[model samples]
Target: MSEALEQVAKNKDDVAANEAALEDLFCVISSYNPDFERDLITRAYAYSKSHHKGTLRKSGEDFISHPLGTARICADLMLDSVTIAAALLHDVVEDTPSTIPEVKKLFGDEVAELVDGLTKLQKVSLKSEEEEQAENLRKMIVAMARDIRVILIKLADRTHNMRTICHLDKHKQIQKAKETLEIYAPLAHRLGIYSIKWELEDLAFAALHPRKYSELQQMVSQRRTDRESYVAMAALQLEKELNNVGIQVKIEGRAKHFYSIYTKMVRKGKEFNEIYDLTAMRVLVDTVKDCYGALGIIHSIWKPMPGRFKDYIAMPKFNMYRSLHTTVIGPQGKPLEIQIRTQKMHQTAEFGIAAHWLYKEKGSSAKSKEQAADKLAWLRQMMEWQSETDDPKEFMKTLRIDLFEEEVFVFTPKGEVISLASGSTPIDFAYAVHTDVGHHCVGAKVNNRIVPLHHTLHSGDFIEVLTSKSSHGPSRDWLNFVQTSRARNKIRQWFKKERRQDSEHIGREQLQEALRRKGLASQKIVASPEFSELTRSMGFLKTEDLYVSLGTGKTSAQQVVTRITRDMDSVPDLA
Candidate 1:
């Protein structure tokens, strides 16, 4: 047997002794799956173990345990065998000498590609860590173009890593944990992966401020018994009432996550006691009509807090999450949040993309496919956006600003729901709806009020963008006001095509500023290989053509700077 395989066997025996209950739990969960595909999973596990054989995690456990645990989590999500396999081997490429080719030979191309997508690039001497992070994000987006499952597996791997972060040093813990909060957690939330999102946020918060985490944990623990009693009483009453109406619904109550509660405290300046909706109940019904029926029944039993109700069923979230949410004053005049949704919505809310496998297991392949397509649309959009720009820093910045920012939902004239970033203006909305509408947008009417084109859209606002037949296209200033990258890119494309002189002028000014920052003045940069290579990579046939395109306002100043700096290593040192 390989040394790594022997080590893993020994580690398994140790775990069986030290964490017997957890081992039993894992076995029970694994046993429940009739189609475990044990051979594929076992081989992948052995490969990971071999790659990380002699290494011990900061937690003092064998490094292989982390990947094994991550794979188990993916299994719990009911992901495919390939996804579970990929999860098991995710860290091998980055953490060990194992290459993508080796992984492909061991597993298959699909698994290798998934691992490559999840792998972080090797450190280079040329870039700062922040620049490296931006570049890594850019590479991940490029990889995402191939298959989205890579991202899903990466998220699961990150979630598991964050969960066990307490084993690392304080500095490393805080760094990794904050990254989880700032990036991975938000990404998961965007993908509707609430289970991963909540865990990531909580663990990150714990690592960043252990004192605060502990205090909050203690405070919540003290109220646990009372909270359970109150929830039980409420559930009993709700069940009795719904049962009387012959409404078959399953109701359960849960306390808000610590990080969620902390965010409310920080953002709204509220005390822990002042957060009224700490404990909430969710009702899952069999059908859409039953969901509404359950909501009506719940509201009949308690008075709802005005303006605290939202009907997401009519206008679902961008991630396709649907539910009827209401904050109500219960029996003791205490506020409680109630969520009503169909069983399918419940599964989607809990498992997100993984719920597709759940449906497949139940022989609902059509529904599974639809859900997968809906979830994968964001991946396709990311790929599309990446194709429009070659500057990795700018691409990363635009993606972070567009995808991870807060979102607001608006409606078209036909009542089709459109979601944009929270501060997004009507111009952004116009571009999101259609590039043509945005290009010729003359004015906007938001909820029948004649508002400026720059008016920020709010949730539930019925937006109508006025367009002119005369192709008086998008204003240059609209790019500054627009929140989404899609709108910005389209506007740039329009200028690139129609206003060469203006684009060239803007591009020249941008390129000059970038050159100055890099200590290469206009005269020096004109002959520099860096400048020539940048333009070439940007698809310009000639250096002069590139300069003229920039001078004409066809592209962004930021994009010019990014490309130059990224290729700085190849440039002759002006210094």
Candidate 2:
């Protein structure tokens, strides 16, 4: 037993020394940013180590090791000293007796705020274990709205947790796996952090569907040799083809991960043998011109599959992802997927948000900050959706709808590209353009042809929304077709303001008829001071609000009458 314990400790030390020593983290960050504050990092490490000493995780490893590992990941992103400090101190407030105030005192205000935002997530109260998996999702989103660093820290924390999930019990493992799939993985994808996003997915899939995961893993393993050989042969041919065109390029082959293959299998309802593009050939070039040149060459080499091409370089994703993709016939008669991008784009593809920190050229840091702010503008949009309803569950429902969608890129009349969630309609497009445009929109033309408001937009379609000053406002029917929460919220807001008077008029008529049926006078009820109280009891601040609810089918006049009768019955003979 003693010998085994010594061996385990020795192995742990060896692994850490080789790959993730404290000095390695320092050296990596210094290489990226020559002006970084190494002294501050060392102090943060000592402070976090002191606070977390003597604690042990479920794996029986020292708890301080978790913070150290998280900080190491932050260093890998080439983050600043403050973010790395926050990563080390993130769990102290939630786990230890220390408070946010102490973190502020010890680490300053910025790091303290991040730690506070993280600790707030530990207090989520959900409906049930099964139904409320995304209960804390809204809270994290709201926190992200305040500071994008909050989520970056939290995502790093979650990555470490998921990496060590094997230490947890089976029941807890399933719970965490579901949470990661439903929330963190999608969040990472939205942030364009594919480095952690793909790993989180595979880890969760392994835990949640152990048998299926093992089966797919074995399948991938069995095909490793054949796929490598095929990819090698294809790379050589592609390199020669590009070289003849004088477009200097580097070719690499990437095997698809198990989770992606499984997703393709289920999404397309195909077996492994039927799945095409098991391995993607990525071509890196020097310039944007060379990217398109390579694409044309790849197509000329192999017969291009119809509708299997996407030009993301021309129209980058909202998260700033860019690549040119095409599927074509290759050796072994297999459909090969090829991606072409510049070297800068390839870095962005791999590191995503971290790419901004990886280079320290002049003006790059400022540009990166501006880009980070732009990317997190979606957090403000999520907050806009949250403003409509207080129910975290409902917010999460809409959030999931937005999160799981594949992107669709459409164009404006002027040729500017507008990216939206897949399945978005003309109304969603109009709203995405502007709230005022959506409100006054009377009709739309897609590709110079008139289409209904509910017309689902396909990629590459140019959309023109026809507006009229005489148009009253958005119709309630638009809700039935609008897909994005941004569009849905804007439409609901228009009705909530514009239709309140209409709702009140309709509600008053409905109330009068109900009063007559109950043999009570409507005039008397409105004249009484108790009317506002009656509306308040029904969860409305004013009678007009009650009427608006009635008009929207959210409440009925009959229910109001029943409440009135109960109130009257409670009164004594003074009535």
For each candidate, the alpha-carbon lDDT, in order, equals 0.77, 0.80
Per-residue CA lDDT of model 1 for 1-575, tens digit only, reads 99999978977785564355334424644664666556777788778877897798787777877887787777767676677788889899889999999999988876787788777533444456666666666666665455556677778778878878777788888789877887788777777778888998898998888888899999888888877788788889998998898889888886689999898999999888887777888887888988888888888999989999998888777666889999899878888888999988987887776666651332443455465766665666666676776665777678778567776888998999887878999999998888899999999999999998778889989999999989679889987788888888888888767766665566676777776776765656666776777778889977767767667566666677666667656544357
Q: Give every collision pair in model 1.
A: 502-552, 503-551, 503-552, 503-553, 504-551, 504-552, 504-553, 505-551, 505-552, 507-550
At residue 290, give the lDDT of candidate 1.
85
lDDT of 2: 0.80
Model 2 clashes, total count: 0
Error of 1 at 539 (Å): 12
Those runs of model 1 whose alpha carbons end farther than 4 Å from true positions after fitting are: 1-32, 97-99, 120-126, 359-371, 389-397, 447-449, 469-471, 492-540, 543-575
